[model samples]
Target: MIRTKSFLSLLLLTALLSLQLTTRAEDGYRLWQRYDQLPSKNHLKQYRQSLGEVMVQGSSPTLTVVKEELQTALGGLLGQPVTITENSRKKEILVAGTPASSALIKGLNLEADLQKVGKEGYVLVSKKAGGKKYTVIAANTDLGVLYGSFHLLRLLQTQQDISNLQVSNSPKVQHRILNHWDNLDRTVERGYAGFSLWDWHKLPQYIDQRYLDYARANASIGINGTVLTNVNANSLVLTPDYLRKVKALADTFRPYGIRVYLTARFSSPIEIGKLKTADPLNPEVIAWWKNKVDEIYRYIPDFGGFLVKANSEGQPGPQNYNRSHADGANLLAQALAPKGGIVMWRAFVYDNNVPEDRAKQAYTEFKPLDGTFKQNVMVQVKNGAIDFQPREPFHPLFGAMPKTPLMMEFQITQEYLGQGTNLAYLAPMFKETLAADTYANGKGSTVAKVIDGSLHNYSLTGMAGVSNIGNDRNWTSHPFGQANWYAFGRLAWDHSLTSEEIAEEWIKMTFSHDPGFVAQVKNMMMGSRETVVNYMTPLGLHHIMGWDHHYGPGPWIKDKPRADWTSVYYHRATEKGIGFDRTKTGSNALAQYAPDIQAQWGNPATCPEEFLLWFHHLPWDYKTKSGRTLWNELCYRYSGGVDSVRAMQKTWNTQQGKVDKERFKQVQMLLTMQEQDAKMWRDACLLYFQTFSKRPIPQELEKPANTLEYYMSLDPKFVPGI
Candidate 1:
C-alpha cells in the first residue's frame, strides 16, 4: 500500500515539475506580446487603478477580440484580472468601440476626431462622463477600435504613462502587408528560417494556434494584408483545393482586419485554364482569367489582390507575347477591378539578352509604361534597383513614375545580410532608402513621400515586406530577427518614426525596460546594418556573394548562366582599377536619375564615399575621402567590417545576465559565428581583389588565415533555402 502511494506521488511530482519548466522557459514564442508583470510597484498600482473596469461596446468578432485582448494584457501587466462590465460603476473605466456601436461614444461629440482619422484610424482619449473618469477608444469602424486597443496595451506594456492619453493613430500607407515567399511544398524561397508555416494539406480542416497568433501580431502593428504564396507562383494555388485552405486563413485573419492576397502566375491560363496561350490581348485568355478571379472571390470575398512577377528571372509574362508589362498587369487588373481587388506588378525585371546595366533595366522598362497601368495596379519596386544587396541606392522608379502608384518592397529575410546567422537590424537600411532625396519634384521630394502618395498624389499606396517568419519556435530563426519584422510593420505604418524610436519600443516590449539595457541594445541595433555593409559589401561594392546560394565571398565568381549573374561583371576588377564605371564612359546609368542626383553621384570626387565604386571605377593609386589610396581603403573597409563584428561580440557579452539565458546564449553563439564569417569575408575578398590590385595587405591588419586557393576550394554543400 505504501509503495503504491509513493509511486503515485512520484508521478504527480514529475507532472508539476514539467508544468513549472514550461511556464518559465523564454523560448521567444510570445514575441513582442510578452505582457509580463510590471517591474515598478507604483506604476502597476497606478495602472490597476486607471484600468479597474473595462466596458467595451458592440458585439462583433473584432470587438470581442479587443475586449479579450484588453482583459488578458491588463490582467497580465497589472497582476490582477480586470472586471468586464456593460455599465461601469467605478470611477475609471476603459470604454472602446466605434461611435455607431456605442451610444455613449456617439454622444461624446467625436465626429470631428473621427473625420481626422479615416476608416482604419482610431482616437483614444481620457474623458469625464457622469462624474466618472473614462478612457475611451473611439473610431468610425470596428477595425479602428481593435487597433486602438492594441495601442493602449502597448502603452501599458512599455510602462508609459497613460493618464494624458489623447492620441489619434492611423496607418500612413493604405495597405501594409507581409509577403510570405512560402511555397505550396512548405519551402520558403530565400528564407533562412525553417520550413513554411502554412500546412496546406491540413490547413482548411485543422487551424493551428500559430495562425491566430500570426494574425494577432500583424494586426497589433497595423498590418492589414498578407500575401500567403511566393511571387514565383504555382498555378495550383489558384485551384479550389488551395482556395479552400486560403479561405480558412482569411476567416482566421478577418477578426484582426487582415486580408489575404496571392501571387498570380501569369502563365496560369496555359497551365491551369486549358488554354493554348497566355496572351494578355487574347479574348480567350482574358475570359479565362476573369472566370478564375471570380472563382477566387467566391471563396475569399475580401481578397486584397494579385502580386505578379513576370518576365523576370524566367517567370513568364506578356513580354513573351510581345506585349508591354502594362498589358500583363491590366489583364489581371481588369478581372480583379470589379471585385475591388488590386494588382501589385513587380518592377524587378532584368533581360540578360539586352546586356544593359542590370540596375538601369528596371527603370527603363517601367518608366515608359508609367501612366498606362490601370487604376487598381500598383508597381511594387524594391528599395534598391538591384536585388536586395547589403546596400544600394534607392530605386529611381519611385518618383519617376508619377502617374502610377509605387509600392515599396523590403526583404525582412536576411538573404544577403548574412542569412540567419548575423544580427542585422534592417530599420537603418530601410530608413536610408526612405530618407533618400529622390528630387523627383525638386529638393524636398523624398522616396518616403513618393511612396506615401504625397509626392505624386496617387490615391493608392502600399508597402510590402518579404516575410522572414517560418515554423521555427521563434517565428524568425534568429531571435533578433523578430525586431526586423517588428520594425518593418512599424515603419510601414508610419515612416516618420525614427529607427532609434522603433528600436527602443521593441527592446522595452521584448526585453527589459531597464534604461541601461535599452540604451546599449538600441546602439547595437542602430549600428548593425552599417556594420554588415562595411563587412559584406562596403564602399559601393555589391552582389559579390557566393554563386547560387549567396552564402560567402565569391568575388572570383565568373562564367555563370548569365554574364550579369557573375561577380566579375559587377566589380569589373582589373590590374589598373576595381569598380564598375556607370558614368558617361561606361553604362551611363547615372543619367537615369534626376540631374541633381546625377550631379551628386555622377562625379566620383563629389560623390559620397559609400557609393564611390558603384558609380565610378578607380585605380589602385586613386585617393578616397578617408585620405587612403583605393587599395588601402578597400583593405580598411573589409578589415573594419570584421572588427565591427568583434565589437558586436564584446557588446553582446556584456549583456549576458541582462537578457534571458536561452536567447543570450543563442545570440552569443551566433555572434561568434558572425565574427568567423566576417573574417572569411575580409580575407577572401581582400585576397581576390589583391590579385587585381597587385598590392600588399596592410601590415597593421591581420593576415589571411588560409591561402587564396584554400578559400576558393572550400565549398559549402546543401546550404538551406536553395
Candidate 2:
C-alpha cells in the first residue's frame, strides 16, 4: 500500500511541473493580461461561479478576437478549458455582444444604459430572467464589446468582485493615442528601451507577430490611435512604397479599433513633390498635400491624421514662408477634412534667437492665435510650457484656448526622470497636472476638464502620450515602466481614476496577488514619483540635468550657444539667491496668466512651494514652510529623496518569493542601481549649489563624500536615448 501511494505522489508532482512550465507568465511580454490561475482556491470558486459557459454572441473579426481572447484568458485563470455554449437560459451563462448581434441581450432593456455609454463604451450587468441568472457584456458596437471583454478579463486578473457587477464606462476623451517618435531607420528619439518596433526593412510583406500583440495591448487599454512616424517628420513615409507598409499595419490594427496616423513634413512638396516652394498658402503646396492625403486614404481608408512639429527646433513650417501657424495647420486640415481626419499641431515651438522666457514662449505664441485654427485642427500642448520636467505647473495654454480645441501632450518616456533604470511611477505626476486649477474660466477650471471638452465645450477632444515602447522584450526597459504605460492608457480613458487605485490595480496584475506583497509594493509605487522629484529636482527646481542627454545633476552647466540650453540660465544661482524670477519685477512671464493666477503665484508667501523657485529668485535666508532656511530645506528635501529610494529597495527586497525569480532579481538589481543614482543626484546637486549659498550641509543630514570638481570632471559616455 505504501509503495502504491509513493508512485501516485510522484506522478502528480511530474504532471504539475510540466503544466507550470508551459503556463508561466514570468516574462513581461504577457504584460497585465497575465491570466495565471487564481492564488486562492476560494477566490477561484467565486470567479468560476460568476463566469460559466462563455457565449460571445457575435460573428465578426473583432468579435472573433473577443472569443479567442476570452477563451485563453478564462482558460488560464480557471486552470481549465472554457467551453462555448449556445444556450442563453443556462444559469451563469456569460453572454457578450451588441444588442443587435445577440438576441439574448436584445430581449433585455439596456438601451438607456447603452445610450449613456457612447459608441466606444460598454455595459456589464448581472441580470435574472425567471429563475436563470445571466451575466451580459453589452455594447453599441463591436469595438465596444471587445473593450468590454478586456475589462471583464481585467476584473478577473485583479481579483475584483464580479458576482454583482453592474458597470457602464465610456472614454472621457475622443482620441487617446500613443505618439511613437520612431524614425524610418528603426531609431527612436528619446526612447530608452531599445530600437523602434517598426521593422521598416521587412514591413508590408512580413507582418511581425509583435504588431498584433502591440495592438492587442493598446486596444485592451482603450487607446484608439497611433502616430507611426517621428514628429520630426519624414517625407519618405508619404511615398508610395512606405504607404504600403503603413497600410499593412493599418489593416492589422483595424480589427483592434486602432487608427494609424503619420507625421507630415512641411517641406514634403520640396522633398518628394518636386516643387520649388512648399508654402502652406501656395497653390502648388496646396494641390500636392491634397493629392498626397487622397493617396493615403486610398492605402488606409481609416487613416487617422497627421501630427506636425513645424518651426520648432529648426523644423520647416509656414514660418519659413512668412505665414502664421494657423496657415500651416489649416493647409493640412483642408486636405484631410473630406476624409474625416484632423491635424494635431504641436505647440512646442521655440526660437533660441527670440529673447523670451522659455516657460512663457508657448502661451505667448499660441494665446494670440485662438479661434484661428480650423475645426479639424487640434493644438497639441505639452503638460508644461517648458518641457517634461520632474515637476511643472500646468501649461498656460490649456485654459487660454477655449475657442479652439486644445489637446494635452504628456511625455511617458521619462527623459528627465532618470531615463531607463530608475523606478518612477508617473501616474501621480500625470494626475497632478490634470487636476491643477488652470482658472481659464473661473475657480474649478481643471486642465482635465479643458481637454475632455466639458469646461471649454470644444467639438473635439484628445490626449497624446509620447510612447516609451521599443523593441525591448519587455516593451519598456524597466519592468515598472510598464505601469506608466498602463496608467497613461487608463487615465486617458478616465482621468478621474486615482493614482493609488491605478497603482494597486497595476501591482496586483503585474507582480502578485498576495495581499501583503500587493500592499507593500503599491505603497512603494505610490511614493516613487515624489522620491524621484526629491532626489533629482526638489522644490520647484526644473531643467537642471546635464546638457544634451539630460542624465545626471548639472547645476553649474553654462556657456551654451542658447541661454535656455544651459542649466545656469534656468536656475540663475548666485551669491545671494537661487532661482528664476518670472514675476513683473523680472521677466513678467506671470502676466501671461489670468489676473487671479498672477495675484496668487506672483507673491512668494502665497505661492505653492512646489513652484516657488520656478517663479521667484529667493534669498538663502528665506524661511520655508518647515521653519527652516531655504538652504536647510533644500538639504532636507535632497536627503529625504535619497532615503526614500532606500526604503523602496527595502520594500522590494522583502517581496522576494512573491513574484517570478527572473523579474524579482531584475527589479532587485534595478532598485540597487536607482539607490546609487539617487545618492549621486543628492551629492552632486548639494555640492554644486553649496558654492552659491555658502551654507554648511545640515548637521543631521548626510554630506557629500566628493567635491564639486570631482562631479564636474566625471563624464559618462555612450548614454542611451540621445
Candidate 3:
C-alpha cells in the first residue's frame, strides 16, 4: 500500500511538470495582450459567472474579429471556454454590437449614451433588465464595437471591478497612426529593433503572422492607420509591384479598421511617370500624381493618404521649382480629396542656403503659409522644432498655425534615447511636450489641445508616432521599449491620461501584478527620461551626439558639411561659455512664440534652468539655482544621470523572482550595457567640454579614466539604424 502511494505521488509530479512545459513562455510576442490564466480561483469564478454567455449581433469582418478576440481572451483569462449562443436566457449575458446592427441594443434606448460617444466611441454598461443581469458593449459603428471589446478585455486584464461598470470612451484625435520608417530593402531608419517587420521581398504572396499580430496590437490601442514606408520615401514603392505588396498588407489590416498609408515621393512623377519635371504646378506632374493615386485606390479602396517629406535633407519638393509648401501639399491633396483621403505634409524643413537658425526654420517657413493649405492637408509637425532630441521645447508652430490643422508627430523609436539598449520610458517626455502651455490663445492653450483640434477648432486632427516595431521577437529590442509603443497609443487615444497611469497599466499587463514589483519598476521608468537628458544634454544642450550615426558623445564635432549640422554650431562653446544664444541679442528665435512665452523664456534668470543653455550662452562661472557654478552643476548633473542608471539596476535586481526569468535577465543585460554607455557619455562629454570650461572637474565627481583624445579617437564601425 505504501509503495502504491509513492508511485501515485511521482505520477502527479510528472503531470505538473508536463503542464508547466506546455504553457506559453513569456517571450513578449503577445505584448500587453497576454491573457494568462487568472491567479485567483475566486476572481476567475466571478469572471466566468459574469461572462457566462456571449451574444454578438453583427457578422461584419470587424465584428467577426471582435468575436474571435473575445473568445480567445475570455477562454485564457477564465480557464474555460466561453459559450457563444444565438439566444441566451442566462442571467448574466454579455452582448456586443452597434446600434444599427443589433435590434436588442437599439431597443435598449442607449441613444443618449451613444450620442455622447461619437461614431468611433463605445459605451459599456452593466445593467439589470427585467430581473436579468446583462453586460452590454454598444457603439454606433462596428469599429467602435471592436474598440469596446478591447476595453472590456483590458478591464479584466487589469483586475478592475466591472460589476457596476458604466464606461464611455473615445479617441481624442481623429487619426491615430504609426509611421514605420521601413525601407523597401527591409532596413529601418533610426530603428533599433531588428530588421523591418514587413518583408517586402516576399510580400503579397506569403503573409507573415507578424502582420496580423501587428494589426491586432494597433487596433487594441485605438490606432486606426499605418504609414507602411519611410517618410524619406523611395519612388519605387509607388510602382505596380510594390503597390501589390501594400495591397496585401491593406487587406490584412482592413478587418482591424487600420488603413494603410504610403510615403509619397515628390519626384515619383519624374522617376516613374517619365515626366519632364516633377513640379507641383506642371500639368503633366499633376496628371501623373492624379493617375498614380487613382491606381493606388484601385488596389486599396480605404487607403489613407500620403505622408510627404519634401525639401528637407535634399528630398525633392515644390521648393525645387520655386513654389510654396502649400503648392506641393495641395497637389497631392487635390488627388486624395475626391477619395476622402488626406495629406500629411511634414514641417521638418531647413535649408543651409537660407542661413536662418535651424530651430527657427520650420516655424518661419510654415507660419507664413498657415491658411494656404487645402482642407484635406495637415502639416505634420515633429514634437520639437529640431529632430527627436532627448528634451526640447514644444514646436513653435503648434499654436502658431490656427488656420491649418497641425498633426503631432512623435518618434516612438529611441533614435537619441539610447537606441536599443537603454531603458527610457518616453511617455514622460511626450507628456512634457503635450502639457507645455503654447499660450497661442490664452494661458491654458496647450500643445495637446492644439493637436486634438479643441483649441484650434479644426474638424480634422491626428497624432502620428514614428514606429519602433521590427522583426525582433519582442517587437522592440529593449524589453521596456514596448512600454514606449504602448504609451504612445494610449496618449494618442486620450491625451489627458497621465504618464503614471499609463505606466501602471503597461506594467501590470506586460510584466506582473505584484504591487511591490509594479511600484519599483514604475519608479524606475518614470525617472528614466530625465536621467537620459541629464547625462546627454543637460541644461538645454542639444545635438551633440556622433556626427552621422548619432551614437554617442561628440561635443568636439565641427567642420561638417554644413555649419548647423555640427555640435559646435548649436553649443557655441568657447573660452567665454558653452551654449547657443537664441535670445534677442543672439538668434532671437524666442520671438516666434507668443509674447507671454517670449517673456517667460526671454531672461536667463527667469528661464527654466532646463532650457537655459538652449536660449542663452552662459559663463562657466554663472551661478545656478542649485547654488553651484555652471561648471560644477554640469558635473553634478552628468554624474547624477549615471547614478540614476545604477539605481535602476539595483531596483531591477530586486525583481528577479517576481518577473519571468527570460525577460528579467534580458533587461538585466541591457541595464548593464546602459550603465557602461552612461559612463562613456559622461566621461567623453565632460572631458571634451573641459577644454572650453577650463575648469577642473568637481573633486567630488569621478574623473574620466580615458583622455579626451582617446574618447575623440574612438570610431565605432557598422552602427545599426544609420
Candidate 1, residues 8-108, lDDT tens digits: the string is: 99999999896664345488989999987888888898888889789987889999889888888888898888887777778888888888899889988
Judge candidate 2 at residue 542 and give its lDDT.
93
- Model 2 residue 670 distance off true place after TM-score fit, in angstroms: 0.8
Candidate 1 residue pairs in backbone clash = none
Among the numbered candidates, top TM-score falls to 3
Error of 2 at 332 (Å): 0.2
TM-score against native, each model:
0.97, 0.97, 0.98
Q: Give the true-structure RMSD of model 3.
A: 1.5
Deviation in angstroms for 455 in model 1?
Answer: 0.7
lDDT digits (tens) for residues 1-722 of candidate 2: 99999999999999989666644547688778878787778779977876757887777899988888888889899887887755655667788889888888888889999999999999999998767777789999999999999999888888778888899999999999999999998988889999999998998899999999999999988999999989998899999999999999999999999999999999999999999999999998899999999999999999999999999988999999999999999999999999999999999988998897888888888888999999999999999988999999888888998899999999999999988899999999999999998888899999999999999899999999999999999999899999999999999999999999898888888778788998899899999999999998887999999888899888889998889889998988998999899999899888877788899999999999999999999999899999999999999999999999999999998987667778888889999999888888999999989889999998889888788898898778878778
Model 2 compared with the native: what TM-score? 0.97
- Cα error of candidate 1 at position 23, Å: 11
Tens digits of per-residue lDDT, candidate 3, 1-722, equal 99999999999999988666544357889999998876766678778898967988879999899888999899888888887765788888899998788887887889999999898899999978867887899999999999999999988888887888899999999999999999999999999989999998898999999999998999999999999999899999999999999999999999998999999999999898888898999888888899999999999999999999999999999999999999999999999999999999999999888777899999999999989999999999999988999999999998999999999999999999899889999999999999999999999999999999999898789999999999999999999999999999999999999999999999988888889988989999999999999889999999999988898888889998898789988888888898888889998999998999899899888999999999999999999999999999999999999999999999999997777778888999999999988998999999888888899998889888899899899888988898
lDDT of prediction 2: 0.91
